[model samples]
Target: MNWDDLRVFLSVGRLESLSAAARALRIDPATVGRRIARLEEETGTALFAKSPQGYALTEAGQRLMAHAAKGEAAFLAGAAEVAGQGGPGLSGQVRIGAPDGVANFLLPQVCASILDENPELELQIVALPRLFNLSRREADMVVTVSAPTAGRLLVQKISDYHLHLAATEGYLAQHPPIRALEDLGGHRMVGYIPDMIFDKELDYLEETGVSRVQLGSNSVSVQFHWVAGGAGLGILHDFSLPHHPGLRRVLPETIRLKRSFYLVRHEDDARLDRLNRLAALLSERLRAEITRQEGLS
Candidate 1:
């Protein structure tokens, strides 16, 4: 019944590791283990199954988790209200889960500006090429290429960005001239690994009838760099082109691809004023940044 115990329980359940929970909580692993034990004893049920693989929640733990999450959300909401009563500046941490391309090329300047404006605010960008579980608190918010179909979530379209086959001037000069899409077949291609394309929108090369990539990576930053290095031509974001002056779009008029970024957040978080403000600012800045960068590209 203790809030402290429930906090520990939630951390362990989400991370599935006592050590990781301890590190996140800034406490020792022994303390986290003791808290979980006390929680289990209070409920008179084993909350987790122990094995070499780490803790797996028991049926009782699963039930407790749902209620505990609601409590945690309420508690955080109250804290935010209290903190915001004194000032407009945001405090505390906000973590974002995004695909590498956005995280790497776009969020740096965007988040930097946010941090500069609110010195008390902290941001963490988790660059991963997989879906984030907002229910488990993998991230406070997520920027995704596609809108999620299921979840208690709010989705907003931030902006529409373009991508096209791009290569360095040096590479284009050395390789066979690409007057059209079919001419792309004569040159090496760098792109996403075929089977590892997690989102259908990301299967950009597929549109060009490129069945194979001469160099493939799941990370957008990697593919962008490969193209920048003149290793091979790849479908790259228009926003990213400003970073490499040597890079030039190939068949720009014919091969332009459009994609949109969606901002996603848990519906429960809508009650928090600070998050609402932050999300608004984030969306506005992202939209402007994409437009500004794409103009330069």
Candidate 2:
């Protein structure tokens, strides 16, 4: 009957792990387990089947979820409206998953700006080389390189960022000339490991007409630094180049790639005003960063 109890139930159910549920809620794992037990006892039924994989909902828990989810919607809507009345500041947590490049270069700045404006809001950034599974509740929202065509989801293309071939000036001076894409094979190339590219949109070597990678990493930051360390020519975002003065564009006119970032969330969650506001803020920041890099801002 307690709405707060439903909050615990939904978190545990969606995350499917007591520890993860606790982490998201900012509560002790023992507290989360106890709350679930209390909720099940109140309903006179076992709400979950406990296992090493964590908790799986019982038939009763599944039935209760529909109404609980509706309650959650109402609660979030009320919170959003109330927060708007006071000001545009947000409360509660938002977890965003993104690629290493954006996460390392952009998100920390964005989060700092957001936190400055909203001291009460909580933000978690998961920067990984692999794709985040939104369906599994890995993140409240995800920034992905490509958009999915099929899903009961809300998707928006946040930005189209450009990548250019680059290398340390010393390396460029010493290496074989890349007169053309055909000449790329004569020089050492650094790139994402072919099979480790979790997102197909990140499969950039083929677009560059260069497949012979002498050095590689799944982590873009590592690859960029390796290039800066004079390892080899690499494909790096134009926006990220300014920070590495030693790294010069190898052939900006020839080897280039354009990739779009898509923000996605479950359709039902689109109703949460806090989430939408955060997404809009991120979208605005992403576009502005690209423009700033282009010297258009």
Query: How high is the CA lDDT of each candidate model?
Result: 0.91, 0.83
User: Would you list the clashing residue pairs of candidate 1?
Assistant: none
**Model 1 scores what on Cα lDDT?**
0.91
lDDT of 2 at 271: 77
Query: Candidate 2 regions off by >4 Å?
Result: 1-5, 22-50, 57-67, 83-86, 90-92, 114-122, 135-137
Instruction: Quote the positional error of residue 226 for candidate 1 in Å.
Output: 1.0
Candidate 2 lDDT (Cα, 0 to 1): 0.83
lDDT string, candidate 2, 160-189, tens digits: 888888888898788777678787878888
lDDT of 2 at 249: 78
Compared with the true structure, model 1 gives a TM-score of: 0.94
Candidate 2 accuracy as TM-score: 0.82
Q: List candidate 1 segments past 4 Å from native.
A: none
* Top candidate by lDDT: 1
